[model samples]
Target: MTWRARLLALDGLTPQLGDADRLVWTTLADAPDGAELVFLGLDDGRPCFAAIPAAGDAAPRLANPQLWGLMARLPAADLALYGGARSLIDWHARHRFCAQCGGDTRLAKGGWQRDCGACGAQHFPRTDPVTIMLVEYRGRLLLGRGLGWGEGRYSALAGFVEPGESLEEAVAREVLEETGVTVPSATVRYIASQPWPFPSQLMIGCHVRASNDAITLDTTELADARWFSREDVATALAGKGPFTAPPQQAIAHHLLHWWLNQPATA
Candidate 1:
């Protein structure tokens, strides 16, 4: 059976298929042929996977990419919930130490909290804020190409939230810092969110109205930057662009898709 997309959320995770204990740590196991493992991060004593091909069938299946690609297909609720589990598990695996003092931390409260043995400090899982926005002006969207991505691939502008700022402020600051475009307060609208676990990030998607159209590129962050009409964006989404949209599973892609489907307001 074709695997349907399910979000990773408190409500998204259903009960286990059976009472037999499941493995949490990564292990080498012999998966039956034509099966794909959709790894659900560990919670308390359980780790889950939406084991595809429940029984016997013959077809080529996904490896790791196919597993992660599941995010794009799932609803925001499910993605947020499932990604939450993944992030929590990942944080638990890494935060075995106290940053305040060189102390060891022990897992407590079913993998949610880490208690320090040396200085009595408590640590929790983190969700690093990321501002992902579609900067709009004159019926065009601002796009950028990152250094690490393939050539001719462009997506919405994005950056990390600094120490003392809200999500809207981060969107404005990131647009200015990366592309020298000023985003207005009235136009910064929240869209959706996604769990990006390259190393634990919560990507907050938004639509921003730019005060100016001209771009001043910050070479360290973006290789190239420019404005594209909705038509141009539509072409790109259709896989005909010199630059393409981000992966369909990403919040960036969702923002862009929504923008493309809307009537031009600016």
Candidate 2:
């Protein structure tokens, strides 16, 4: 995966096998010294592997880069495999030293763990939890855009899940912090989750009911925010509205669609 600013991602390693089907097979060999090869489990009884090229490493040149379209249409299983490989490889690259004692680490467990020789510590890949919420008022949904986002493009508000906070509490706090809208923990509802491979984050999607439709801007966190009606959201999903919704690949898109389908009383 190739990404810039954590959003514009291209599955440059994937190639199309059939009509709109993605396969993670690559012809790149494990070469040029110090390349990290990951054993990414079995695929239809066949072992699969991924190669992460070391800095300044020389790889075999390829005429066709095997780059594919946006990953939104990738099969779920393939996407999961890609995500796992990316996360593991990234962890190996970044965590070469043990945090506990600042000792050099060695790979173990077929690329699943790192062992520190100096401090006798073991480390594993970490997945951070983030809360993406559908903040709903009586009949509207709150959407926000961070600084530098394209004008008129808005999606669900989200923030990292702080330590010692439940998912429900995280949802309420994120909503309140970003938009200054009070949503009690009791009114927060979990909707779904997805594995985001942009440096390995688990996006926890939720719905939160706000007590009122009031807005206070946190300029440091958001460039703009507003509550759109069901019809406005529906229009946005259909490609014409006051603001554009996120792409289909994002869990936020599904959250908006799910809420739009629910009865008004909900």
Give me the candidate number with maximum lDDT. 2
Q: Quantify all predictions' global Cα lDDT against the true fold.
A: 0.69, 0.75
Quick one: how many clashes does candidate 1 have? 7
Q: Report model 1's TM-score to 2 decimal places.
A: 0.72
- Per-candidate RMSD vs. true structure? 9.5, 7.3
Residue runs of model 2 more than 4 Å from their true location after superposition: 1-21, 27-32, 55-69
lDDT of 1 by residue, 3-116 (tens): 333322221222121123221222324344543344554444455443322322122221245444555555654555555555555565566679889698776764567889
lDDT, residue 39, model 2: 69
- Residue pairs clashing in model 1 are 7-78, 8-78, 8-81, 8-82, 9-81, 9-82, 72-249
The local lDDT score (0 to 100) that residue 87 gets in candidate 1 is 56
Q: How far is candidate 1 from the true structure (C-alpha RMSD, Å)?
A: 9.5
Encode model 2's per-residue lDDT on 1-266: one tens digit a residue. Answer: 32111111213233234455665354334223556566677655555666543421122311222322435567877667666766667667778889999999988877888899998899988999999999888888999988877789899999999999999988888888888899989988889999876667899999888997788989999999998999899999999977988977779899999998899854
Pick the TM-score winner. Answer: 2
Give the Cα error of residue 116 in candidate 2, in Å: 1.0
